[model samples]
Target: MNQYLISIYQPDGPTPEPEILEPIMRDVEAVNAELREAGAWVFAGGLFPPSTSTVLRLKDSEVLTTDGPYVEGKEHLGGFTVIRAADLDEALAWGEKVARAITLPVEVRPLQHGACQ
Candidate 1:
């Protein structure tokens, strides 16, 4: 099986109120559980807002560190799940479920080298 990354993107702004977010989170967890049951789950996690990111760049042969995301965008990667899938079609199938659960755009991409440690 190949490993895939299911990337979840969210708008750049304050999170929704609990009433709006709680159900979404519940659905996300449900998907996570399903992945575990299927033996496809590798790892998954949510991220803090992009504002908290620290970017590093190689400039003039020196590493330059900057606060905040590498790029400013209306949306940022808010979370991700790494899973094992038989192929692209299977990975996309899981990505669809995650997108539905979060009500956001999700990207399903295969890992280039191999599975994660």
Candidate 2:
């Protein structure tokens, strides 16, 4: 089986209030449960906001570290799931479920060689 990354994207700003966010969290939990039950879950997690990210770049043997994400954009990866599936189609099917559960955009990509595939 091949491994896929299901990346969740959200606006790069504050999240909704707890009252508005609880349902989303519940849905996320349900999705995780479903994935586990289906034997498709390898790993899953929510990430801190982009502001918490640290970017490190190496050029000509010099390392440069930055305080925020590598890219300055309105949309950021909010979280991700690594799943093992039979093929790209199966991976995309899981991604659709994730998007529906979280009510957000989900990007599904196959892992390249040396990337735990």
Candidate 3:
């Protein structure tokens, strides 16, 4: 089986208020349950915003750590799901469900290797 990553993208901005957030989270939970029942779920979860990120680099044999993502961009990964499927088509099917649940664009890609990556 090929492992694929189904990433949910949220444009940079203030997060939605709970009134908006709660329903989406519920929908996402429903999708997660369906994936679990279908055995298509490996793992999935939400993430903190980009502001909390820390980057570490090696310079002159010393570790240099910085705040923020590797690169500055308007978009950062909002959340992700990892699943094992027979092929890209199967993986994309999963992505479709996720996209619908979150009402956002989902970026799907096959991992180079299963588990090791």
Candidate 4:
């Protein structure tokens, strides 16, 4: 089975209200449980706020670090799940579940072979 990364993205920052977020959190938990039961779950997690990010780069043996994301954009990765699936279609099917549960955009991408190991 190929490994896929299912990433959540939000353009306006994280959900604003606990009332709205609570249900989504429950749905996310359910999805994770289902994935684990099905043996498809590799890893899953939510991210800290974008303000906590730090970007680093190395050039000519010099290390440079910055206080924010690599690119300035409205959308940022909010969370992700890694899963093993038979193919792209299967991966996307999992991604659809994530998107529906969180009511957010989900991006699914195949991991390079052997990358997971």
Q: In model 4, which residue pairs have backbone atoms overlapping below 3 Å?
A: none
Top-scoring candidate (lDDT): 1
Worst 10 residues of 4 by lDDT: 10-19
Candidate 4 residue runs with Cα over 4 Å from true position = none
What Cα-based lDDT does every candidate model obtain?
A: 0.94, 0.90, 0.89, 0.91
Writing each residue's lDDT as its tens digit, candidate 4 over 63-115 gives: 99989788888888989999999999999999999999989899999999999
Q: Provide TM-scores for the models.
A: 0.96, 0.92, 0.88, 0.93
lDDT preference between candidates 1 and 2, better one:
1
Q: How close is candidate 3 to the true structure, as a TM-score?
A: 0.88
Error of 2 at 47 (Å): 1.2
Q: Which residue pairs in model 2 clash with each other?
A: none
Best-performing candidate as measured by TM-score: 1
lDDT of 2 by residue, 1-117 (tens): 788999999987788999979998899889899889989999988899988999889989999998988989999999999998899999998999899988999999998856873
lDDT of candidate 3 over 1-117, digit per residue (tens): 788999999889998899998998899899899989988888977789988999999999999999988888888899999987899999988899899999888999988873545
Model 4: per-residue Cα lDDT at residue 108: 99
**Candidate 1 residue lDDT tens string, 3-69:** 9999998998888999999999999999999999999999999999998999999999999999999
* Candidate 2 lDDT for residue 54: 90
State, as a TM-score between 0 and 1, how close model 2 is to the true structure. Answer: 0.92
lDDT of 1 at 56: 93
